[model samples]
Structures are given as structure tokens and as C-alpha cells.
Target chain A: MEKFRANLMLCAGTGCVASGSAKVHAALRDEIKKRGLEDELKIVLTGCNGYCAEGPVMAVYPDEIFYQKLTVEDVPTLVEEHFLKGRPYQKLMFKEPEKKTAIPLMKDIPFFKHQVLRVLRNKGLIDPEKIEEYIARDGYLAAAKALTEMTSEDIIKVIKDSGVRGRGGAGFPTGMKWEFASKVKSDIKFMLCNGDEGDPGAFMDRSVMEADPHSVIEGMIIGAKAIGAHHGFIYVRAEYPLAVQRLQLAIDQATEAGLLGKNILDTGFDFVLEIYLGAGAFVCGEETALMRSIEGKRGMPRPRPPFPAVKGLWDKPSVLNNVETLAQISPIILNGAGWYRSLGTEKSAGTKVFALTGAISNVGLVEVPMGIPLRTIIYDIGGGPKKGRTFKAVQLGGPSGGCIPESLLDIPVTYEDIQATGAIVGSGGMVVMDDNTCMVGTAKFFLEFTADESCGKCVPCRVGTKILLDILTDITEGKGKESDIETLEDLARDILASSLCGLGQTAPNPILTTIKYFRDEYESHIVHKWCKAGVCRDLTTFWIDEKMCKACGACLRACPSKAIVGEKKVPHKIIQELCVNCRTCYDTCKFNSIRILPAGFEGDPYEFLGIGAAAATTGEKKGDA
Target chain B: MPRLTIEDLKKIKEKHRADFTLREGGYRAKVTVHMGTCGIAAGARNVMTALMDEITKANLTDVIITTSGCAGLCAREPLATVEIMDQPPVKYCDLNDDKMRVIFKEHIMGGTPVEKYGLVVGSETTY
Candidate 1:
């Protein structure tokens, strides 16, 4: 083989590719060739680096320098400065949001430092398209061990001892699931991988499938050996074209290398794997519904009496695992159950990967040991809320999960602890919200998604969610009655109890948790007809607080509707007829002068402008909203 | 291709150990060729290529080859630094492909600094 002095691991994951990593790759190749440094350095396009907020990222090995946000114009200078002169370029390195200095090393960056990469172990370290790179990292060694050295019972025992649960959301013990299927007498058993990650704002499984597809494959290989399964299917959604392509490539590579087909590792263990693309239905993420979908039926759930372990995917005994759960199996087999149990809590004995997004400063994917406090993941790893904003809540587990308030931020993030807060760490999508977000509108946002995605298999989910969405929309549009909150609560509880699958069962979580934590916002919308966050235009009256106004005319320039009437040294006022309620003035005001009042407040605007004075204190003078 | 046995997996791992060492960081010795504009202008690339060829020819996986910026001494172009585990770093200046080959054989392989080509025996101040 050939030897090179250094390796340039450029990120080619979906996020980076969307941010133009392909153009960056071409620029790098051209620059390296132009400088005659092509032979001395090797450029390898790897998977997600996890710092997606800083896309077009690259890590130069041997020196360990990390560069971010590389443009085509930067490629020539970067090649001359770093690649040729061997000096790490500081211009494109990651700079702390507050600090001016740049961080050069990827290990030293806080976002990468605090993460424990188990599921994402091969991410950004190897070329996802190369099986050799995967094997070089001891990728399939566990599959080899499970095939050649361990028996079917032994593999189950090790996984059971490791205490890893289903990372898909339910937190069911993986070993017990495998053991149940192993006990059933079936000549043709199935080992299925749930890659149908349907949660909005969640891409943890997609990253794993795209970055290290072989890890999932190797995990399935071990899982198949454990459960006596001769056939497997990875059911990924059709929306993830990159994940599908990489997974297909990885399967072909593994089969060609003789690690995947028949007689694997010369142990006579045969397992054939294939990919099944889902047509983007949210309910298909449910195991039973996923199995039904694979059987060429409409992806709907049946009540779990047989539980897929007894009857699944053509009615033979089967075992279905999440993409993340399978990615963790190889490491457990190679390093023993004790090693896997060393980092996390006793019950949730492993790390979980979270897709951090929304108003958070660092929008990326992070893997942290289970039981780490929600505060650390938010403040330390996420770098807190975006600048000029204060955190209100973090919506975990996507729409199937609930919003955790600031009061519970200190709680440890185990399966039980998060569940105690009325939130499951369901698929680990943490969307941070700032103070400007209206809680009622946020609840309505999630309700709209669930309402649209309800498969209509059962009456409760189909009818109840639509009713809930209608009530939320009415409240946001200033048509709320005092009794609507109680009605919403009752309907949400009924849907949660009577839903057929995981989708409907957990769809009401956002509404229930938001009402529990931010009921004051809901009441304000219903009775007072005011959205203090200025999100719902029908319930908001924009007013200028003259005491704090700077007369800067910034709002005048920013308002799209030409509603502001003011001159130099004069406080600006909105012409109510022309004001579009766009919240541009509220966001544009530098002096905190713009205040949201009750809808159609005709009383003295200055009366409630004082801090802590309620618009309702103006008494019967309130206009009809 | 034939199906691989357990031995083949181990063999492939060993074959790729040298390539992964650069990324995973477990090497007994490190050789940093100062490839600054001044160094590269004076044949530092030749010195680097020669050192890499020597390591591959000797089938050594424990030695790392890397590059860095200028060493603050442009007069001594084509500078190289050698640091073994738990030992002070040694700098060699004004080198060519032949001289790099000799340095690899005597200093890198033998674990002893070649005093003839040595400039300094310690690193610059960090703080």
C-alpha cells in the first residue's frame, strides 16, 4: 500500500454536503494538485463531524487542526498556509461565541470535548464508503467474535449484562428482546432495524446510517447470530436518500468482503441483509406498524399481544431494533459488557445521541453519557440559547415528547428521570426555545404536525387530535373561550389513553406538558386576549414605551408596513390601521421600548407600560379583541 | 474474492495500523518537518518525502511523520524536529533527501541523536 504524511478528513455528511462540501472538495483537490502536495497528503471525505452549525468542516490529522466554514475561495489560502506551510490557518477555525480567539484543535472545542462518541465512534474519522477504513477501526471484530467464539446464548447474556436499552424510545432492555426471540422455535426468524426515524427536528439515526452504515450492519450481524435469525431488513425512510445510498454501498462492500454473506468469518453463520425504504409515514416508526409496512400493508399499528417477538414480519418470530441500538452492539461485544456499563447510569447504561437545534447557539448532534444533567447539555455543550435571548424550555423527543421547563434543567437525563418530568428521551431531539417564543403558539405548532401525521387508524387519534388543533388555533386567533383549556386537557388525556400506536399515544405530550408548565400563557391568551411574546398577531397590540424609547427610528426603517410615525428625537408610534403586527419593531428595538399590550387596548398606552403592570388593570375600558 | 476467516481480519488490522496511528495518536516517536514557505522553498518537501519512504521501507509503525510551520530560523531552511517518548526534542537544520535518510537511520531508528547535524535539543517556550 501507499503511505502519506497526513490525512485530510473533510466532512461529506448530508448537512455538510447541503452546505456545499462538494464544491469545497473540488477546490481542495485542485489546490492540493496545484501545489504538488497531492501525493504527500490524502483527502478523504468522511461522515458527519457533529459540528454541523459550522458546516464545510475539515480535520487535518497528525496535526489535529480543525477548520470550519470553508468556502471555495478559502481553499487556495488554506492549502498554501496549512497544507503547504504546515501552519494551521486561524481564519477559518471555530471561534467561541463570546471569546474572540479561535480554537484550532477539534479535541479542545467544548462541543466535541464533552461528547462521548459510542454510537458515533466512526463518525468523521473514516470514509463511510470504504470498508477498509471501517475494518481498520476494529469495526466488525465483535461480529467475528460473536460468530466464531460465542454461542447464541452467550451473545444474549453479554448484551443483557450490558444493560443497554432500546435507543428508539421505549427504553426496553435489548437483551430481553433478543432473548425472547431466541427462545421461540422458528426456522426463519427476522432481525429488523428501525431506520424509519419520523420525528421532526431529529436526525440522530440518519447521521448514524449515513456516516457509519457498517456499524449498523455489523450490529445486525451480531444481533442475527444471537437471535438465530438468518434474514434481516433495515427499514429506512425514503426521505433520507443519502442514508439509503450509503447504507446500500456499505452492504455491497460488506458482502463483497465476505463478512456479510454466507459462511461469515468461516463459522458457517449465514445472514442476508436488505434495505426496505418507507414512504415517509410517522406511524411506521412503531415496531408492529413497521413490520406491517414491510409486509406490504398500510403502515398502521395493531395492539401488541404477540409483540413481534412471537409473531412479526410474515408471522414468524422476529426481533426489531432501532438504528442506534444496533450501532452500539459491536462495541459491547468487543470490549465486554462491563466496559459499556462504565460510563452511564445503572439503568440507562450507555450514551445517547441528541440532535441539538432551535434557538440553541450550537445546532448540531451530540452524544453524552446517560444521566448527565440537562443543564450541562444545554449550557455547556449547546453554548446556551442564541445571543440576546433567554432560554424558556427545551422540547425533547420531538413532537412525541414534551417541553421541559427551566425548573427541571438540573435533573439528570436518565430514562426514568426524564420520564418523571413528563418527557421521555424519545429519540433524543432537543429543540431549545427562547423567551420570544409564545408557549401557546408552540403547543399549537406541535399539534398541527401531529394532526397532519395522524394515520386515522383509530378514532381517538384521528378525531381527538384534530379537535385539539382546532381549539389551539382558536385560542391563538383570539376566539378562545374560558372553558377551552379544560376541554383541551380532557381531549388530550382521552387521546393519550385510547391511541393504537406510539404516534397517537405520545402525540398529546406537547399539549399536556405545555399546559402543565406554561398554563399562565394559555390563560393570558384566553381571558386577557394578550400574547406577551407578540407571536399571535390577533391577540397582540404593539405599543411604544416612551420612557425607554431612544427615538432611533430603527423600528421605522425595519417595519415593512410603513406604520411608524416619528422623526428625530421623537418617540415612534404605530399607526394601528397600517401596522402588520410583524414583530419587526419588537425585535429591532435596541432600547427595549416596544411592548406587547392586550388586543385593541384603547386606554392610555402609558398606563400599563410600567414593568409588572397588567393591561387588565385598566378595567372595563378594554376593546373587543 | 473468497470469504475471510478470523485470521484475515487480524491481518488487515495490522496492515492498516500505520495509517490509523496518525489519526488515533499512539506513536513511540514523532518527526515534524518544518515546511514553512522558507523551508519548502529550500527543498523541505524532498526531505519529508525521503523520511516517509524510509519509515515505509523499514516497516515501522511506531514513528509518526508530521509537518509544522516555520521554526523562526529561516537561515537554516529544511529543518526537522525529532522527539521520542519521554525524551527532549532534537532539531536538525539544512537537510536534503540523503541527509534525511541518514537522520532516519541513526536518530529515529537507533534512538540516539546524530550530533553532526543537530542544532538544538529542546523545544521553544509555549507560555
Candidate 2:
């Protein structure tokens, strides 16, 4: 086999592709040909590189030069100087933020340093659409091994030994789930891959599906063989068009290659895989609801105890695992149980892929060992919060999970560790929060989401979520009575205990966790009728800081309510009655003079700004006098 | 052609193992415009089309163009990363027709990595 002297691996993942990686690829190819160096240098378009903030990204092999934010025009120079002349282009390299020096290799970056890529191992390494590239990396070998070498019981035993749990929120033992399905007497068992990821700010499953569709397919093949299931269904949400397209293409490719469909690997066992597109309902993420949707019924959960293992998917024994769960199976089988078990803590033995988003500087997909600390993920891997903002809290597990304060920054991230904090690792969606975030408002946002997503199948979820949202809305709007806190706690406890399914059972987590960590913020809202973050419009009063205001007409021109009325070069006075508190004037002000005060503050609005309980306790307001 | 079976795939893999040349950058340059929903919202498709038309007009054979999904930075779209063999790769932000041309003439052919326009500059050994 002929190997090129160098390989130029461009990030073709959705993030970099949008940043114009295709143009970069074309320009490089054109430049290489123009320079007559085509045979010596290669350009490989790979999947998501994971460092999404600095894309369209590419890494030159042999030298491993990492370039960020590329354009099509730069391709020729890169081709001429680097591929032909063998010179490193200094301008295209990545610069360290704290240090002024440019970094030469992709691995040297701090973001890539801390990540343990297990699930994301093949993400940036192969062409997802090409089956040959996947085969080259020993992709279907595990399926073949399971089909020919291992018995169904042996496959289940190996999986159980791997200690791999579900990456989906529950963290259920994957092998045990398979074992139940394998032992069931049904002649037609089913394997279901749950791609109905509904959590906000979460896209790890979608990325895996888009970047390495074959991995999920290979995993399903092994799973099907283990469970003695000849039929499989991938239940993906319709919202993820790209994941859907890629998954369908991958299924087609696998079927064409005889890796899927009847008599796979020339073994006697026959299996068929199909796709089931969901209508983008958050409730369908629940196993029962998802199964119902698959059965051409409204997506609603039925009571458990019979569970899916006993009677699932048209009343047949079925095994359902999330996209990430299935994706991990092939690797566990390929590497053996001990190899997989060696990485993480005792309970959660494997890496978890998180959609690291929100106030963090580098927002993208990240996979780390289960026991890694939150501090490491936030500070080291995430490049800290955006704009040097102080870390306040990190919300994990989406709306169904809870907010973890900075006090728990050192806490190891595992199923048990996170769950111990009253937060489940629900689908690995981690949204970082800054100091400016309003805990009450954040809780309210999640309450609203849960209220909208509740299937209304159970009265506790249907009615309780609505009441919770109403109370939260009232508190944020300064109409909340002090008794509302007790009411919220009461509702949270009842909802947790009585909700019909996982969606309702975990619906109050955001509220419960936020209230637990930042009860003071809720107290401030109720007692003082104030929004500490000035995010709640009803509790805030916008005024101009006379010292800082140049009386620039910017606020006057910007305010839709015509709230700011003052002559140029003079301090503007906001009409309290006419001021809709729309915050247009506050946003438009360049002088940083706009201020928001609690309802009772008479003068010097800045006194209320940034004054937490410490200032109140000290009885010494710096700017008050 | 018969549907490819696992045996056929194995045979193909074996056959390709000896003769297959992992072809280096010979075809015309390939431009992958991120047309993922987020990228399109960021205007990646227009930028991609501009680059495509430019390469076509220039009669560039070594280039192949394609599209990809989102790269996380919803705030910055129509972003493009450029790679040439010997030179360091450059990513241009807020790209328009003019910047694309400058990239085509200066970086693609002239062997110079553009400054100012790139988010990160110079190569590192870490990744």
C-alpha cells in the first residue's frame, strides 16, 4: 500500500463544515495540483474534531500542525509552502491564550489534553459515509467475532464483565438488560436504539450518529446477536435531519455489505434493522413512551413492573438502549471486559460523552472518563467560562437533572457521584453557568420546558408541572409570596414521588437543585421582591448612572418604549411609568451607565448591583453613600 | 453488481490492501461548506458556493467540494478553514467574496498564511 508523505485531515464535522472546510479542501487540492505536489500530499476530510469553537479546523499529519478558522483562499499557500516546500506556515497555527506563543501540534492544546476519547475515538479519524474506511479500522470485526466465536450467553457474559452502564441518564447495567432479553422465550426479540435525545443544549448522540454512524450500527449488530433478536429499530427524532440522513445511509451501507440483514457474516443468524423517526417529543425519551411511539400510538408511558424486558414493543421481549449505549457495545466487545472496566471508577466504568455548552469558551462535544472532576471539565477542557466570567454553577443532565454549584467543582463525575448531589447524569448535557446567571430564572426556564414537554398522561406530571411553572413565573415577576418557597419544595417532593415516568419523576430536579444550592436567591426574590441578576424584567428598575451617562442619544434612540427622555450631554431620566423595563436602553448604552435596582431603592441604583448577601450582612455598601 | 456481502467486503479489503494507493492531494481542491442548520444560519452555504464558483472559474481540477454539519460556535458562522500541504492552515472568519479571493490568490497559491483574519495562528504539537 502506498502511503503519502503527509496527510491533511480536515474537520468535516457539522461545525467545521459550516465554517467552510469544503472550500479549504478544494483550495488545498487545487493548490497541490497547481504546485505539482498532488502525489506527495493527501487531504482527508474527517468527522467532528470536537474543538468546535475553533473551526473549520484541520491537522496536517506527520507534522500534526493544527489550524483554526480557515478560508478557501489560504489553501494554495498551505499547499505550496507546506506540502511542496515542507515549510510550516506560522500564520495558520493555533496560539495559546495565556501564553503568546503559537502551538504546533493538535495534541498540545489544553482542550484535547484532558479528554479520554473512548466513544469519540473514531469521530475525527474516519469518513463516516465510507464503509471501507470503517472496515479498515476493524469496525465489523466485533460483530463477526460475536457471530462466529461467542455464544449468546458468552457475549452477554463478556458485556457484563465490561461493567459498561447505559450512557442514557439511568446508567442501567447494559449487559444485564441484554441478558434479560437473551433469556426471554420470545422467538422474535427486538433491539431498539433510542436516538430520541430531547435535552436542551445536548447533541452528543446526534454528533456520534453524524460523525460515526457505523459505530452505532456495529454495536447494534452485536447487541442483536447477543439478544437473539433478528429485528432492530433505531428511534431517532425528526428534528435531527443530519443524524437521520447519516443513520439511514449507514443502515443502507451496512445492509449492502451484508453486515446487516439476513445471514450476516455467513453465519446462520439473520437480522434486519429499520429506522423509526420520532415526532420530536421530549416525553418519548422515556423507554415506554418511545416504544409506544414505535408501535404507531401516541408516545406515552405505561406503568412499569412488566417493564420492556418482560413485555415491550408490541408485547414482545425487547431491549432498548440509547444511541451512546449501543455505540459503546462494539468497543467493549473488541477490547474485552477488563480493558473497558479499567478506565473509570468502580460503579461507572467507561467514558461519558457530554455536550459541553453555555458560558464555556470552547462549546462542543467532549468524552471523559466517568470519574473525572467537574473542575477539570469546566476549567481545563472547556477553557473556563467565556470572557473570564466567574463560574457559578454547572447544570448537568439537562432539565431532568440539577444544577451543581462551584462548591462541588472537585466532585468526581460518575453516575453515583453526580446522583449523590441530587442530580442524575441525564444524557450528559452539561451547561456551564456564570456569576451573572439568575438561579431562580434558570429554575423557572427548566420548569417551563418540563411543563411543555409533559405528555399529560399522568395527572401528577400534567398538573404539577404547570403549577410549578406558574409559581416560578410569579416569583421571577416579583409577585411571589414568601410562602411560595415552601409550596415549591412541597410540589417538588410530591412530583418526584408520584410522577408516572422518568420525565415526570425527574422534572423537578432543576428546581430542587437550584433551590438547594441557591435558596438565598429565591429568598431575595420573595422577601425583597428583587431579581439579583436583573434578568427578571418585572422586579427590575432601569435608570441612568448620572456620573457615567454622557446623555448620549443612543439609549433614547434604542428604547422602543421611549423610556429614556433627556437632552444631549445631560444625564437622562427614565420615565418609570412609561419604562416598560424592556432593557433596550440598558443594552444600547455604551457607557455602562444603565443600572437596575430593586423596587424600593430610591437613589444610586448601582448600590444594588453586585451586592450579594455579604454586602447586606456587612451593612457597608460601597457606592451607596 | 451483486449486493456486497461480508465475504465480498472481506475479499475486497484483501484485494485493495496491496494495490490501493491512499491518494494524496491530487484532485482539484475540495471545499466543504458547512451547511448544517447552524452553519446555514451562519451563512456557510453562500460562502461555500462563492468558493465553488471561484474554483470552477479558475478551472481548478485538484479541488472537490462538499458540505458538513455544525461546529458548535453558533455565534460565528460562514467560517472557513484552509489547508495546503507545506504551509500552515488558516481559518478565515466572517468570510465574504473579497476575502475568499484574497485567500484564493494569496494563501492558496502564494504560500502565505493570512494574519488578522484567522482566529488562531501557528501550529502546535499537542493534539
Candidate 3:
């Protein structure tokens, strides 16, 4: 075969394709033909380039020139200048934000500089659909090493020395899990990939599978060889249609290449992989529950001691690892345990990918080495909070995780460091919050989600989550009692102690963390019956700020309750008695005239609701008022 | 077909005689277009098309083009980076059809990278 002189790699990942990468490909081919240089320059559409915020990205090989945000019209200039004359357009380069200078190479961007790509090393570099591109990059080299060079024991020892843990929540050591599965004396053994990532606003696994499906496949093959498992399953949520499709295609490609199926790398070890679609149940993320679903049963957690390592799917020894965790296997094997271990902190080796969303400037996927400060991710990588909003809190680990206040912003992110603050490094879902967010409302939302997703198998999770949601809901609605706070703490402890699985055990995290950090917000709700952020509709009453009200009938027209009563261009009076506190007038008032005051204040909703001193109050002495 | 053992894969790599230099000339031009969701939403598709069409129309096979995902400057969409051999690469923001044509003609094929539209200006080695 003739060697191609130059290679042009395009990010054909979903994000880029949706942004018109296909058209870019068409133009490149057309231009190459028009210039009669098609043979010299080879253009290949590859997988995702992790920095999704600046996508439609491409990299030129040998030189490694990185460019961002190109268009159709630029094709002619590209053909005229760079293609024929050997000159690149400086105007289309990537600009360094702080230095305000243009960066020519892909590696120079700070987003790429700080990251030590292990799982994502081949993502943006290879064509996911074509097996040859993957092979060209030494993709299946690790499985080759494991099958031909190392025994099952040797493979396990190498993994053990790597210090890698499950990227899925819980941080269980990967090699130890494999060792236990391998030791179990069972005829049937299974390897499962926990792709049922139900955490809200988290898509790290999806990105990996989409960009590098073969990595996960290669990882699983190695795991099966080590654990003596012949059958494997990738339990992906039904919601991720694209990931499922890509995974299936990858399986077919690997089979064709003899990388999977009967004789993988001619090692005499036979294995087959199947895809199981999860019906959007959050509990299935738990190990036992996930196993049950893979076995075509209702997804629910079962008792431990007879753990999955001993009796898993169909009462066989089984090992389960999340997509991100499995994706790390091949790289560790190929590069050596020490190379993988050298990047991250001592406890957590290798980089972690996070789906940074909500109130952040750069809201997309970020893969950073462990122990990097939260401040760097939030400010430097994420570009700080959106709209110049002051950073308030970052809710890590989803509903099963806790909120870390700004005071903890400087804390280095790792499994143990985050756990020190009572939050787990769950699937890397980091939701940024601003001061405008009401803590009580935020806690209530998480409780509602946990309550709804509970499997109802255990009494503590089913009943306790419901109770927690009710109390949090009451607090957000301004009916909270001081005793309610104590009751919440007590119930959280009870659930933690008695719940059947990790799901229930960590269900109370959001509420407990909010109470720990923002106890004052809860106090104001119980004693003062006021929502400081004015987000809780029931606790607020809208009144016209007489000085600010222009009464152009705008508020009157906008008010669903007809709470504003005044003529045009004149000062409007908000009828306190008629107001339902829906705040329609407040939302409609362009003049910013509407105001909400605490319960006992002159403009308070308590007077309008007619509760007036008859309402129950907790914490304060009865005669204090 | 026999089952491939780990040793077979190793032998294949050891005995591999394929050419390592698939592409020739260190003077090839590179263009990177940011196609993250936000960039796409801001009409990066058109910008990518313009660049490719111009390169094709000019019969410039040495010019390579590709797309990547978000660079975090969401406020500016349709971002592109251009690099010519032996020259600095530059990032351009808010690209449109007209600007793309000028960039393709004057920068990518003409040996001169447009400076005014550049968001970042530096050598490719630093990144």
C-alpha cells in the first residue's frame, strides 16, 4: 500500500457533526480535488476532541496544528494560501484567554495542557468507526499483552500495582475486585460495564463510549481474561441511543478484526459481549440491581455477603465496572502500571473526566488530573460562573452527593478529599450554583428526585426518602418548624444505617449537606417564615414599591391574580388582601416596583394569608415577641 | 481463521513493515474548527463549509481540515484555528462566509495568515 503523505483529522464526534463538520469534510475533499492535491493530503473524520466547548475542532498531523470554529467560505482561502503556498491563516488560530495570544498547537491550550489523557488519549486522534485507524494507534496492544505475555495472575497483579479504582462512585479498587471474582469457584463468570449512568447532568461515560468504544471493549476483554469470564454485558441506559449504537458497531468491528469473539489475538480465550438497555431507573446503577437488570429481571438491590463476586448474574462470579473505569484498563496495561499511576494523586491514579454544567462559563466535558483544585476547574477551565454571577456552591456527585460551599473552593478534588466534606466522587457530575439559587429549594429538588427514584424495596429508603422530601418541601414553602430540622438529621442517620444499598444510604446527602452549610437559610425559613432568595413562591408577597411604581397597567395586565389595582401612568397599589403571592406583578413590572417582605413585616404575606400570629413558630421563646 | 493469541499481535507489531511517514512534507497546512454544541448552535457549520469549499476550489491538497469540541469561549461561536508550515497558528472567532473566503484565499493558500481576525497568535509548538 502506498503511504499517504499527509493526514487531516476532523472531530466527527456527535457534537462536531451536529455543528456542520460533514459540510467541512465535503469542502475539504472538494478543495483537495480542485487543487489536484488529493493524493498528497489525506482527510480523516475522527472521534470527539474532549474540549467540547470549542468544538468543530481539527488537528494536522506531524505539525500538530490545532484550529477551532471554521466555516465553508474559509475553504477557498485555505486552498489558496496554506494548501498551495504553504502559509496558514493566523486569523483562525486559538486565542489564549489570559495571555491574549494566539496558540498554534493543539497541546498549548490550557484545557489540554493540564490534562493527562489516559482514557481519552485516542479519542480525538482516531476514527471511531474505522478499525484500522484504531489499530494504527496501537489500540488493542494492551489486550495483546495481557493474553500473550501475561497470565491471569500476572494481569491481576499489574492492575493491582496500577492503583486504579472504579470511576463509578464508591472507588472500589479495580484489581481487588478482579482478584475476588477470579478466586470464586464458579462455572459461569460474567464481566459487566455499568453504563447505566443515571446521575442528572452527567455524560462523561457517554462521551467516552462515543469517542472510543474500542477502548472499553479492549478493557473488558482483558478483564474477562483475568477473571476467567467468557460472557460480558454492557448495561447502558436506553436514553443513550447514540452510545448504544456506537458500542454495537464497535463490537462488530472488533469481531471482524479478530480482536473479540472466539479467538481474540489467537489466545484460545473465547468471549462474547451483549448490550442490555436499562429503562431509566437510577437504582440500576447499584451493583446488585444492575446485575438483576442484566439478567432480565426487575432492577432491585439484593442483600450482600453473597456479593456479586461470589454470586452475581445467574448466581455466577461476576465483576462489574463502569464505562470510564473499563476504558482505563487497556491504557494502563499498554503503558505500564507506573506510567498510569504517575499522573494523578497517590490514592487516585489517572485523570478523571467531568461533565461541568449549570451556571458555568465553559459548560461541557473536562478531563483533569486528580487533586487539581476546584478553583482551577471552576475559574480557569470552566471560565468562572456565567453572567458574572458570584460563585455560591457547587453540587458534586448528583442527588447522592453533597453541595460544597465557596469556602471549600480551594480544596483539591479527589476521592478522599471530597469524601472528607461528606461528598462522594460520584460519576463526576458537578453542578455550579450562584447566589440566586435558594438552598432550601435546591435541597428540596434533590429530595424529590431521590424519593421518586427509590425502588421501594426497603422501608428506610421508601418511607424515609418520602418523609425527607415532605419536610424539605414544607421548609421551602415557609411552613417549616425548628423541630423539623432535628427530625431531618435523625431520619438521615436512620436511612444511612438501615437502607439496603448505596442508593438509599447516600440519598440524604443533598439535604444533609445543605443543612450543614446553609443552616441559617433553614432557620430563616422556620423562625422568620421567609425565603431569603424570594424563590419559594408561598413565602413571598408582592407589593408595589410606591416610589418605583409607574402603574402603566403593565403589572395589572401581567398579574394573573389581578393583585395590582391602579390607573395608567399613575402609582399602582397592590391589594394585599387579594394577592396570592404568585409574583406575576413582580415578573411583569419593568420598573422593578414589586417587593417581597418577611412574614411579620408590614408587606408580609402572612397578613394577606390571614395566618397573622396564629401560625406555629419554633426555636424562639413564646414571650419574646 | 485461528484465534489470535497475545503473541501473534506482538509478532504483527514487530514484523510490521508499513510506512511510518503516511503523509509527506513538513510544510502541510492545518485548520481546526471548534464544533462543540455551543459553537454549532452559533452557526459553525457554515464557517466549516466555507473553509473546506475554498480549499477544494483552490485545489489545495496540502491543506488539512478538522473539527473539535468546545474551547470554553461559548460567547464567541464558529471558532477556527489556522496553521501554515513554518509559521504561527491563529484562532479566529465569529467567522462567517465572507470572512471565511478571505481567510481561505489570503491565509490558508497564499502563505500569509490574516492577523486582525485572530483571537490568539502564537507558534504551534507551544500548544
Q: Report the number of the highest-lDDT candidate.
A: 1
Best candidate according to DockQ: 1
- 1 versus 3: better DockQ goes to: 1
lDDT of 2 by residue, B31-123 (tens): 334444666666664575566556546645454443445544556666666767544545567766667777777766566766766655433
Model 1 scores a TM of 0.97
Poorest 10 consecutive residues by lDDT, candidate 3 chain A: A616-625
- Candidates 2 and 3 compared: the better one by DockQ is 3
Query: Runs in model 3 with CA error above 4 Å?
Result: A1-8, A17-42, A58-104, A541-625, B1-127
Query: Cα-based RMSD of the predictions, in order?
Result: 2.0, 11.6, 9.9
* Model 1: residue A329 alpha-carbon error in angstroms: 0.1
The docking quality of candidate 3, as DockQ, is 0.10
Candidate number with the higher TM-score (1 or 3): 1
Per-residue lDDT for A1-625 in model 2, tens only? Answer: 1324346778888788778888888887787788665654567777788888889888775455788888887777766455543456677888877776888776798888888887887776667777776776667878888888899899999899988898888999999999988888987889999999999999899889988899998888899988888999999999888788888998998887678888786787788999999999999999999999999999999999797988999999999998888888887887899999888988889899999999889888899998989899999889898764588999999999999999999999899889999888889999999976889999989989999999998888999999999999999888899899899999899989998899889999999999899999998788877676678887777778777789878998888888778887778989888888777887678787877677555543445465323322444443311
Give stretches of model 2 more than 4 Å off.
A26-29, A543-580, A584-595, A604-625, B1-127
Ranking by DockQ: 1, 3, 2
lDDT of 3 by residue, A520-561 (tens): 989978887777566787666556666667768888888777
Candidate 3 local distance difference test against the native: 0.79
DockQ of 1: 0.68
- Supply DockQ values for each candidate: 0.68, 0.06, 0.10
